[model samples]
Target: MIKKVILLGMAVFMTGSIAMAQHGGPRGNKRGMAKDLTPAQLATLQTKKMTLALDLTAEQQSEVLRINTEDIEARQAEHEELKQMRLENDQSTNRAEAQFARQKARLDSKIARQEKLKEVLNAQQYAQWKKMNRHLERNRRQPPQ
Candidate 1:
């Protein structure tokens, strides 16, 4: 009986350690540098870059700033919502509802952004914007050297 009890305790400890290690025991993925910045700061930075890239007029700059602000706010809200969902459902695998909602939100945001950009940009600028966006997306998918 004494030997059996010691073995059971050892097994429990080993399992617990393994579980902790799998779930980012002491050094989980930290927030990236961009996440450390305020949403307003990020919006302003992105808007300025877009303005420079597209040679935006003052009116276009303001419009782009507004769109960037809305985009940043929505992204920040989604981040918080995802974090909350993770915390609440750590071991739950039934994520269909959450996944559906996330997908819908992403599509809705994309459509809204495209419409807003269409209204704000001339045809040539819109074409340039789309090309630049595709290039950025391609680069983003590539792993850093």
Candidate 2:
């Protein structure tokens, strides 16, 4: 009887462990963590991170925060607009055209953001920021172990 109880407990424990592992933590395994966040929240997080990484002054921090907030808002709006376009099922917009537009808009936003950062950050800081972004891109491309 004791051996049976021990075996039963082990099986239960193993099942629970497997269930939790498949559940992907408390949030249900969503891939993009930021997808559900508000633009303001995302912007604030990004600005704070940048401030910490770059040792920004008060003025620079405020400027960077404003830039981040605006960037986030723009991106959110673009995403919503694209979503609306998809929902409308407008055959007028071909897949290639939509993709091209999206790519162009994304690149434009990046260029504008880089230029704004260049204005706010000194040369050394800007170079450091570029390096940081490159490293992050590299890490994002690699498969997780």
Tell me, by TM-score, which candidate is best.
2
TM-scores, one per candidate: 0.72, 0.80
Error of 1 at 96 (Å): 3.5
Worst 10 residues of 1 by lDDT: 24-33
> Weakest 10 consecutive residues, lDDT, candidate 2?
24-33
Q: Residues 95-135, candidate 2, lDDT per residue (tens digit)?
A: 89889989999999999999999999998889989999999
Candidate 2 Cα deviation (angstroms), residue 28:
6.2
How many collisions per candidate? 0, 0
lDDT tens digits, residues 47-93, model 1? Answer: 89988899999999999889998998998999898898788875565
lDDT of each: 0.86, 0.89
Clash-forming residue pairs, model 2: none
